[model samples]
Target: MVAEEKTEGQAAPELAAETAGRRMVVLEDFKPVAFLDDDDRASAVRRYSTLFVVDGRTRKGGLGRVLYAENAWGDRLAVKVLTAEEGADLTEEEQQALASRREAAFRREYESSRLLTGIAGFPTLFGQGRIDGQPALIMEWVEGQTLEEARRRLSVDDDGRLSPLVAAAIGRDLFDLLSRMELVDGGLVHRDISPSNVMIRTQRASVEEQAAQGKFDLVLVDFGSTVLPARASSLTVRYGAPQGATPDYAAPEMLTADVARVADMRKSPAVDVYAAASVVYLLLCGRPPFQLGGSSTGGEGAEVASDYLRKTTELPLPVRAAHGESADVTVALDREGEAVAAVRKALADERLSPSNQDLKEALVCVDKRVGEVVLAALEPDQRHRPSAAEMREGLAGFVEAYPANVVAALQGEPLFQDWSFDERRKAGGFEARRRAGARLARWAAVVVALGLGCAAAALCSGVRVTAVGSLPCSLEWGFPLVAALALAPAAAGYLVRWRGGRKRSGLVRGSVALAVVAVAVEAFVLSATVDPAAMKGLLGAAPLACSSAAWCGMVLEYSMSAPSAWATAKRPAQGVSGKGGSV
Candidate 1:
């Protein structure tokens, strides 16, 4: 007998009792639930039974409930079972149709699992079976949160956007997965590629080692919407065009209004390409490339309906149409030209703009090339979008540019590259500029303070210039003049730089001033009389002069070497790569 459904927060013993005696009926060769042929109907299908028990808690998703279960062999599994609305009435025919639909969905997912079993980034399937009269799939239980959950944990910026560097890494993994999918039987399209469908798990060896290397594995799941292109025509006729895909991430082509006209076009891998780009865009900026009415205020259903309308009846008027250039506007343009025009108009939609400034700031951490690639992938026309393989190639360059140090910084719990010189200033790139300005000010202040202190000491020591090339050096006149010359260069240079003079000009002026001071000091020391007492006085003056000059030169060098204007505006490439796909 079937056990009664257990409510949430039930006692452990009660939960165990609820799962007792559940038999999983596994078929050796599964057949389609609908349109079963004679061969499928006549055979006594080979089958087996496995006793499995649900343990711990249950997790819910859009289409099903997932619970942790262990088979008779004590191997853990994630069993996804169909979920029905609590209260609904249906006629006999309606009930059977729903049952057939549910069964077909289960079979489709099972087939996809089998097809993708050996592919990296996907979980291995155990088998498909029935539990309490509901279809369930037994697959490897991945241990980690969904990518959506990971975002909240990994958000390290002032705004909640994930670092574009990290997002690019994730996007690269996604494109790699898609590229591998293309190799299977002339390519498979995972029509649904949303955050909730991707799992983020640590490939834990040693936490320290992995953090140092900056490695984590992303596993793609929920393959029920997977489509094999060769069978697309039959599937379209049977199941309708533009099969189930998440609306927010779905491509413009996937949501076309006249499904019949684009049925052939739907078979291309471009749908997945668009969705992958949208996912990367969302990660970088915290919103999709396009949304209805400037936001998702009206909810998902409205957005889905609006997307269909936008791609069809409500598409923008062409450039020629608005200008009234011709009475017969459609006479000269071909299909490709119309597509190009439509794409241009679509790209101009304000809704397609990033919802926040986070994207611009995040762009500071990645190559401009990465941003270009992402924009190209989000193209409205499928022909304009690069293949998944191409995207992977474009991203390879920038992804390689992120140094191991940046990865190490990212791996710490804080999730920010605080140690990175570029990452530290990536938030609007203003902080670095501010710091640079402050450093210059501080250096100039130090130079002024030290020069005053040295000049005061020289005056108190009673060091006087004894002569000036055959003229007797006056005690009062020569000392003050020499002090002024030594101090004038740095002081004037600081003022000049502060007044917006070029750094190189200030450096040259300071160098000239220092040279004159050096020559004056050397001449005074050499002209000193042969008496030890007079030589001692001259020697003291030389030390004082050298100290001030050394300190000033140090400050000047630091100022001249300060980061340039470009450092604050554009990030240096941390890495390099051949041309390839971008985020």
Candidate 2:
């Protein structure tokens, strides 16, 4: 019986080992199925039974269909498939060329996304395979609204414009992502970076919760038209073709006929920079830099594109009318017309002789420095435009230099609002100073109480003085100086409270200055009042009183200002915690 029980125990261990080994084998064999042909659909499903199509056609457009799917583990993914039926009306040669372009675009997108994997602000590519004889790329599903949708949802101002702070933040994040992309393999230009391609991932919660959650992140997507170093020539070679650019956001060089075959135009990072500026402009105003008036079809479409191309090539970039401009003045420019001819001419002349003041006038609502950077990027001459790195630096500087609370308020972002409030509290403006003043008042009262206590002690001790130097003196004579010394900090505190412009350091300096003056005055008063017999003691007491007053003043100042100092020291740690805890 004992032997049989031992054998059963040993068999239990062996069974457990067998189960774990089988689990490992199953995990190792797991592979994502690929649907290569229409006929292979059923086999693909059988192989990838764990992956279920949530929505077969989530979105269908001229490009193809976007299929939303999820695996058994509940991990979601998006698959872009180019169906053959999309371009069936075309000739065989046209069909072949179209297929070639589609495949190249899909492969390029996959490669670009793969290269940019692990980047915070770029999408991740999963894998690629053929779906029903057509190429398809699978990418990690990003959950967020596009910048275009977000912008549309924003509450616009009376002038039909988004807040400048919101626009600047968007520009800052977009350029930062572009800068990161450029860091890879010398540089990578996102040939298409429009509003629709940028996604904003923010928490869907109440303002307070959102602020506490602090999750406002931007991601760049759709790299189908990315220009790598090796593919730079492809842009020039494509020439009159669409070049995969929206007419509204395309650079002047991209639209100019003279630069159609220019290799320099294709090689520069200025193309992406120009598109970024255009996106910023769109964010600031409700319209693009060059608004396409008519539908993109037939004669009207050709006319509209031609007109936009001509304006982009010839005319200076137009600014939206200031918020309170008269209806007549606003209506003067056709959406497609050289409507703001005078303003355009002025801007063009300013561009020729650029000045800080002119740039300020050209773009209202946005910071003048940001306007200068954008305008420089939009320069008609591709050679003159700033590099992507330079533009990114400019935008970053603008974001950093602006007041955090103001920017947060304009953005209407809860997390930023909370951060802004904390920053403002740390900065210590008028309200902070007022609070410091109240604390100072309480400190002054305590100092006064101590001084009175010291005077009572002196009286009780019966300390007396007869004569010092050439003057006679008594305990009463020293009392006034003692009282003055004790009250000095209160006076300084009052001055700080009333003056309103001085900082904590300034208050400290003021207190020290008052101490010095009080010491000098005490010396003169003692010299004038005390006789030679009492001079030594009186003189000794004068220095003590002055030093005590100075020390008291410093203590009061520090006490009043310590909260701000403590807040500043603690802020970075708090921020780190907030970020870590946030979504």
Task: Write model 1 residue lDDT over 1-583, tens digit each, in one string.
Answer: 3333222222112122343544342322333223445654333122112335444456764357877666446666677776652315566666666566555665677777778886778888756655555667777777777778876655443234454455666788889999998998878887778888888766454222222244447788887667788774322111223345666777766664445556556667998998888787776666666654423212344554677566334422211111022222232122113212322232233123332233222223333345555766776667656778767755654555433222222222222221232332253245446546656755665555456636644654555455655777555334555455444444544444453333566555555555565566556556653232544454535434544654454454556455555333433444211132121
- Over the stretch 82-189, how does candidate 2's per-residue lDDT look in tens digits? 655334356787767766776676667777877887789876665555543456666667777777777655424444454444566567777878789888877787
Off by over 4 Å in 1: 1-52, 85-95, 203-212, 233-243, 293-303, 309-367, 402-583
- Whole-structure CA lDDT of model 1: 0.54
**TM-score, per-candidate, Cα-based:** 0.51, 0.51
lDDT of 2 at 493: 42
lDDT of 1 at 548: 61
Worst 10-residue stretch by lDDT in candidate 2?
7-16
Relative to the unseen true structure, what is the C-alpha lDDT of residue 132 in candidate 1, on a scale of 0 to 100?
Answer: 55
lDDT of each: 0.54, 0.52
Task: Please tell me which predicted candidate would have the highest lDDT against the true structure.
Answer: 1
Candidate 2 lDDT score relative to the true structure: 0.52
